[model samples]
Target chain A: MARTAGSDGERTEAAIREAAVDLIARHGYEAVSMRQLAARVGVQAAALYRYFPTKEDLLFTLMREHMEALLGAWSEARPATTDATTRLATFVANHIAFHIERRSQTHISNMELRSLSPERLTFILRLRTSYEKELRAILRDGAEASVFDLDDIGLTAMAVIQMITGVIVWFRPDERLSVEGVTQTYLSMTMRLVGATTNRETQHVHAGTRLRA
Target chain B: MARTAGSDGERTEAAIREAAVDLIARHGYEAVSMRQLAARVGVQAAALYRYFPTKEDLLFTLMREHMEALLGAWSEARPATTDATTRLATFVANHIAFHIERRSQTHISNMELRSLSPERLTFILRLRTSYEKELRAILRDGAEASVFDLDDIGLTAMAVIQMITGVIVWFRPDERLSVEGVTQTYLSMTMRLVGATTNRETQHVHAGTRLRA
Candidate 1:
């Protein structure tokens, strides 16, 4: 397929992607049609196809970008210290903030994997494993250093990921808890979940963070 | 709708529900039509409507029954004692077991809420609230009795539910971890996550369990 050019094309493509996410999030990926998406974006189906030749192509793009954006955000948010507790704290905050802000994208990413091709599925899974590996390394280091008591690194990592991602399900900014409030609550639960042994360790981590700030 | 007579009608209803769950689980609920479902079940569209007046009615039944069955299972599994840790343990074990056994139903119940009508959605949400309240009560009791250390009862309960229900996403029967093995691992994680204060407390809880066994 030939590509569109310049800023106008970029704007249209962005619009299409946004509309696709909202539609697919509301309805499952298999049920959404190109015509419906084009109408949502006020574009012709042909224009939509010009950017994405097939419906799966559009879904694959959305999923891949969601993962890539998450990876980028984590890399930027990850602290330079070797302390696992500090690193894990940052991971929880970043994960919650990112998913909460992109609820539609997160929903589509989590729910629409069934609609992807085998090759694309493998690609997305690899992206997820790499992101998860970052947390696993943090958990491993924490367990080894006795800062965190974890029975199974793999299961703990999965549990942490699912628990945090679940924030998007019921969390609303207009609710009793603000994003910061929710993140704080989750951070405390996560610290306890990993068995951060003492309040002193938590305070130590926070004190260092405050000094840096 | 008029009723179906005999065991043959009973079998067809069973087949329709089974086919509907599998199809809706793969493709979003909106994408699935009564015609497609009937075809998959080797019945006519009219026959499907005979059992389910509207497509939404079918979805509501599946969601309602999933919650009802989960509640019923928990009631059977709920321990008589007030030891929060033991009750919490039972809750985790029962949740994982029920969801893992009904993977398709679980997937549908979790993912298809967007397709339901307003009234049906409220009904399903109430069932969920009631079910979740059971966990919230357990957490509240544990916190009140100082058996479990938790930051927030509601958040902790949500985290535990999301973490355990997530087992169905990647878990397979033929995998290295048997259901019991997964349950034990999760049980350990849950115990730690709630900040179960001392090993002695855990052992005390278990000693009573052992004697009963």
Candidate 2:
């Protein structure tokens, strides 16, 4: 597979964004200056400004792209099934994988929201809400089908998102558990939290088989 | 009962911490300056320095006290029951209440950790470990007693904490749901996630009584 290399301008812009995520994640968005970022990226300050007109613009671009990437990942990973349990499992797996791989970008996306302009903040939040709405829809459908039990779809969706996104907080690639293991455990927890009937059956078998050992 | 007033110095220190939490929460810790903080608290920079010799010292103190306050709150709210379900309920409720009440402080504590020096970061993380250890112990004991079902104790503890503490992210005093109501829903979710046998019984009763309506 022959791949065309990026042009020099495109490569410089990519380097700028990469360096920005690292510096901002380390020192925070407000503390990181465009000059410092350009210095780290080995580009002139003027070149950096050519890519991002302002500091806030850089932050907004990073945040917007992060959310867009997440939404994009979920769309690709979403299973072609009406079964809520399977759909939710895909959502959790996709979420944990996406976050763990881009820990720095995810951190900036979450923490730098306060620094975004009001209009930009609203734009990013709207993206977040739409992403969350997908999970809420799954919960709603599950509850209606009587295949899952939940007290509130909105709250459950938030809980599931927080609980799974937290994986990046403590997880390390060299750690004892592999990503697959962690995702499986979290998937079970999610299923149980929502009271999926399949989870209950699995739990019974697991308890019967494993508790004695 | 008669109350004693704090000394002027003590009141000034308290005011600085409050203002710092607000400012740091609004803008990242690296972006907030001692001069700006002193201005917010209506104190001279020298007076602020007399209380916290350096900006990092101020940040370290704010974070250290936040964790200490959380640990103290947990100790007070900890139930006297041997039952894991009851203890877990108390933990969830206390955590939600504590974070919700100190939203700004919680935000600063969670976000400003990267700004701490290595030693200070270790101290804060140690306090966090001790706090999380309590939840781990409960999960371990529950697993032994066969009251709660879980794949990983550490993972479950992290999930429950993140899920409950996330209430502060979206909750507001003027929201449609009361804090108590929100806590109840989370408690139920936590109970289900752990696969507490007691929760199953409650769920059956709840479903029988409420799902039909």
Candidate 3:
């Protein structure tokens, strides 16, 4: 319906989705409407209809696309290192970065997932399952290789995802904390939580040792 | 307003509030209605007016009371202990235990805070501010006493609270995991997160230590 063959149409559609995301993230999905979105986009209310058939469809579109984008970012940033510890750390660091970079997209995508249609809900869960599977594989491999200490690797992987993804709700880009610093903080915290003793344990044992410049 | 003099009326009102908590916690706050609460309480919709004046009033009442209860719990749990390390551990452990015991209450308290009237909303924020003041006092004391090595104690406290609170979304008491085990795990993770070392940290420092006991 959008006639999205040209860049102009695509741009218009993108604008609608952006407006939808902002409005939903601020006021929640149920409180958002196309007329409000149209006004925000500086378009006629009917113009939005060409792109999104209904308000719910618009929200669903935003969530589906956002989730896919998140999954895609993970797939893209995956390093080639076969070391499970490095791979898992990279996975978490990349995830924290993605959540910070696209906070609004991630926020609405998470909060509005409960309002999605059954089929779309299942689709989103499947995507999440794939995402979880990738993380679990690295964790499973780590546990097997004696690099990571974990019980029920699947649950530990899920908990790690939850802990990292939970960062979006509170992280502020304009704050004093640098992304690198926050990522290292979480990496250290998670390593200890999962009983990974390689670095943190060594540091604690040598608490009196000064770091080499 | 209907008579509030009798215990019968008080019991009915309490029942209605409990039902609202359950309904709203299962669905979101927006999706629940007075009629649904009435149905859940097995009473007439009009009779609900005998207790609370309006739908929004009921929501505000439940959320306001829940916050007060959480605040009360924190106050009752805090002891005048000499050791900052023991005090901080007690606080985090008690916070986790409260949530595990009343996950539904915390869920409602969080989800419905946005739905409060501005006047009631102030109470919510004031309550939160007081809670933070108390927690930060411990963190500051710990930092000053040389028991904690946190660069940003306030930010660290906020992160720890958010991380622990976020656990409610995923924890299941019926699982193979015990509540004590989960609490101990989180407590250990938290102590290590704040740079506090323990026997486990020393044990884990050994290169060949097994992960599980």
Q: How high is each candidate's TM-score?
A: 0.92, 0.90, 0.76
Pairs of residues at least 3 apart in sequence or in different chains that clash in candidate 2: none
Which one wins on lDDT?
Answer: 1
Candidate 2 C-alpha error for residue A18, in Å: 0.5
| C-alpha lDDT (0 to 100) for residue B108 of candidate 2 | 86
Clashes of each: 0, 0, 0
Alpha-carbon runs more than 4 Å astray in model 3: A1-7, A33-50, A54-56, A144-147, A196-213, B1-7, B26-57, B111-122, B138-151, B200-213
Ordered from best to worst lDDT, the candidate numbers read 1, 2, 3
The candidates score, on chain A by TM-score, as follows 0.91, 0.90, 0.86
The ten-residue window of minimal lDDT in model 1 chain A covers A204-213
- A65-164: candidate 3 lDDT, tens digit per residue: 8778878877876767687766766677778877888877876665666678889888888887888899889888888888877756655665677778
**Each candidate: RMSD:** 3.6, 6.6, 6.8
Give the CA lDDT, 0 to 100, for residue B85 in model 3.
67
**Superposed model 1: Cα runs more than 4 Å off:** A1-7, A198-213, B1-7, B198-213
Instruction: After the best TM-score superposition of candidate 3, give how far the Cα of residue B68 lies from its true spot, in angstroms.
Output: 2.0
Question: For candidate 2, what is the DockQ-based docking class?
Answer: medium
lDDT of 3 by residue, B78-112 (tens): 65765666667667766777777777777767656
User: What tens-digit string does per-residue lDDT give for candidate 2 at A1-213?
Assistant: 012134477888888899999999988888889989878887678878888999988889889899999999989777687988777777877788889999999889888888877999899999999999999999998999998999899999999999998889888866688776777788889999999987445444332222222
**Residue B189 in candidate 1, Cα distance off native in Å:** 1.1
Of 2 and 3, the candidate ahead on lDDT is 2
